[model samples]
Target: MKILKSTLIATTLLMGISCKTSNNHKAQETGLRDAYKNSFHVGTALNRDDILQTDSLRSALIGKEFSSITAENIMKSMFMHPEKDVYQFDMSDKYVEFGEKNNMFIHGHTLIWHSQLAPWMRSISDSTEMAQAMESHIKTIVEKYKGRINSWDVVNEALNEDGTLRNSAFYKTIGSEYLAMAFKWAAETDPNTDLYYNDYNLTNKAKRAGAVKLVKDIQSKGIKIDGVGMQGHWHIDSPSIEEIEESILDYANLGVKVAITELDVSVLPNPWNLVGAEISQNFENNKKLNPYPEALPDSMQVKLAKRYSDIFKVFLKHQDKISRVTFWGTSDKESWLNDFPVRGRTNYPLLFDRELKPKAAYDSILALKK
Candidate 1:
């Protein structure tokens, strides 16, 4: 890891252009800042810059008052069980250590998900064995990080677009009841930790309703759930502001912590093609590549930044309900938005650009002073 002369970078941003005048709407409300000064947890996924070979990225993060650390894929079941029964904790442990070392809150990404599960988990046939295995895995992982992790996303993306349970292996075997059980077990296993249900594409009425019902069901069962994580993977155009606000309000109504997790706004050619696929692949490689042709132009980048600013401003307005805001990765170089669903599509969907410099989006977010 090479050290970046951040003094130079900060100077450049300061001199890039005059600061734009902010509308009163963007201004912090009275006491809002002090009330939740440290509560607004801005974060991103663990990346190569922070972990590969140096602390240059970590040093960069230190300058910002980040609220927490998101493990992203590190805490996923697949990463933890890459070879089936062979749990490797090296990388994920390093990240957890990094969070504690920095005194940043740690968000354990997912305990259950449909996409990242190992084949063995999906291949199990006997119901008894499956349930027992699920219990063992959850108990072991939760117990291992009992004191260290303050929050755990016990279930991730379990709802389909129509609010039905996705036919994940867990659902196939344990049925929808698994969600309630998972939350209950997690609370029992780590009584001090907050349990959350995490999901993407939740900025819609159907999905929001489904989530509310799920949370209600768990609570009705006397479960000790604490929060709901909305994976804020938005497009530049879709997921209208009304929808976003509604989603937040709906979840907050449940009396739980609402988090904007895995946030990134994609700006690229529509319909998502093969070039997008290549871009996604390259993003994970952690090496520099040519920017995607359809990426936001400089003007678009500014618009994107302003969009994030507006959203953060809204988040501040609802600070009483929201607890955390996490970007998907440190910079465009490491964001999962680049490689997911589509591969090689170039996109600038985060607060930082490839250079690790705070783009307008960064300033826009910081402007939300209490």
Candidate 2:
């Protein structure tokens, strides 16, 4: 009897140990890069802290899950060139180094953007002066990181929702030729790097048409525009699977690689059906707008998972044309949606929860690979 009891206890202990090991192995194996290795490059945008390796958990997760990285803010015009003559390369330098250390496909965000322009650049009214300033800004930044940076969003958000070019400061100053000029400068600066034009709401019919025209016009000039980045800032219900697929095919037809850039599916309600990622748009936070404040209900979690899975199915169907799919942020805790359109709202827009644990959406994405 004593021998039998000892044997039973040992069996129970061994079973527990085996189960624990299996769980640990599963957790370590949940990597986006590995699952989508054959399909396309899986990437995520990293904030300053992530690039600096300040948050060890985030740093490790980013390194393991993503095969490519984009600087969320450090490489933007406002941050990189805040002052006219003063270029802040410290943080951006660290950003490049982090990508190099990880052996990631490092993509520079924007060489010319209307939104985050420096005060001096935006204030330039003369055509010649504006041209010189723009040239200096693009040449200096692109030259400094010429060989190190792999690709760039040469110009971002240059079109309006109605399929017309936005009359931005660059446009008002340098005329419509500025778009072609920006790409020309970037191409001249780095003949090797892939240059892309990025923007939001590109899935919209009119906007997509505008992008098509924009690409063709640049190519007509014999300039190198390698891809068009469709910023996938979608809601759980929006941008039907058909529309997503159509946009991919449309952009692919243009002979430029398609990239799903700045992707995040928001599960919260838009205050007034607000569309597009205009940073200037904001609303007062209230209970109705900020639902799921403390915890996301199980039903919503499942819905988010389904949304991501369906979207990836479209991506998988046209994998040959797609070059990269980069999530805007790493985890829900760091997601920009939480604060955008509405402030102080808890948002569950990413595949990882606040604790940095993989959510159901992450599992669903991985399951598609199998």
Candidate 3:
């Protein structure tokens, strides 16, 4: 009897250990970073709360799941350089620290952008003064985090929907030369870091052609343009796989890497067929627009899963040309989609839901690895 009891106890202990080990293995398989570890760096943008560690769940999820991180807003000019002389490094400092702690590939969001320009910088009309401000802005930010940031969006959204330059303040003040000037300053500031031109709607033929021309122009000038960022602010139905794939190949053909930056698939219906990610565009809230205010229905959830799976399929097919795929946010609750293009409407646009639990979309994306 004593021998039989001892054997049973030993068997029970071994079974417990086996169960724990299996659970851990399953968890590892589900992580985004681990699922695509061999393919590319899986990444997400970090908000201020994530940087401060105020929300324990978000902080932990970011550290565990993403292999790269982009500052969602803090690194932008309005936030980083609110005044000519004032440089806010507190939040951005914490951001880089978090990335370093997790051994993440830190990507500086933007060195020059027209949307969030400070008033002082925007009001400068003289070409020389504008050039000086642009150089100072790019060099100051780039020099501060020179070695720490592995890559940068040297310029963001400089082109319009019709493939011409947007005539932004930079363009109006300094002409189209500002594009090359921005890349040049960033390259000079940090020769070791990768510099990229980031924009939206590269899938459109006209915009794609414009991007090709832009990159080729920079390259022709002997500038070190490393990659192009196709902002993946997509919807469930639009931007078919063909467009995405074609855009990827076209950008790669430029002899520069392609990154799917700011990726998020909005599941909500497009209000008046919204196409671009212009933040100023807004529509009033109503039942017709904000369809799933309470909860995402089962059918919609399945649709979202299929959307994500199809998207990842494209990413995997051309993983060689792709360097990183960074989701715009970590979870649905924190996604910018919740506010942009519409206001105060519940939108489920991420792999994780509001409760910080992985949804069907997450499972579907992980299954692609098999």
Report the Cα lDDT for candidate 2: 0.89
Angstrom error at residue 352, model 1: 1.1
lDDT of 2 by residue, 99-156 (tens): 9998889999988889877887888899999888888889999999989999999999
Write down the TM-score of every candidate: 0.83, 0.93, 0.92
The clash tally of candidate 2 reads: 0
Indicate the residue-level lDDT of 173 in model 3. Answer: 87
Among all windows of ten consecutive residues in candidate 2, which has the lowest summed lDDT? 13-22
Measured over all alpha carbons after superposition, the RMSD of each candidate to the real structure, in angstroms, is: 8.2, 7.9, 9.1
Q: Which ranges of candidate 3 are over 4 A from the true structure?
A: 1-29
Q: lDDT values of the candidates?
A: 0.71, 0.89, 0.88
C-alpha lDDT of candidate 3 relative to the true structure: 0.88
Clash pairs (backbone) in predicted model 2: none
Candidate 3 global TM-score: 0.92
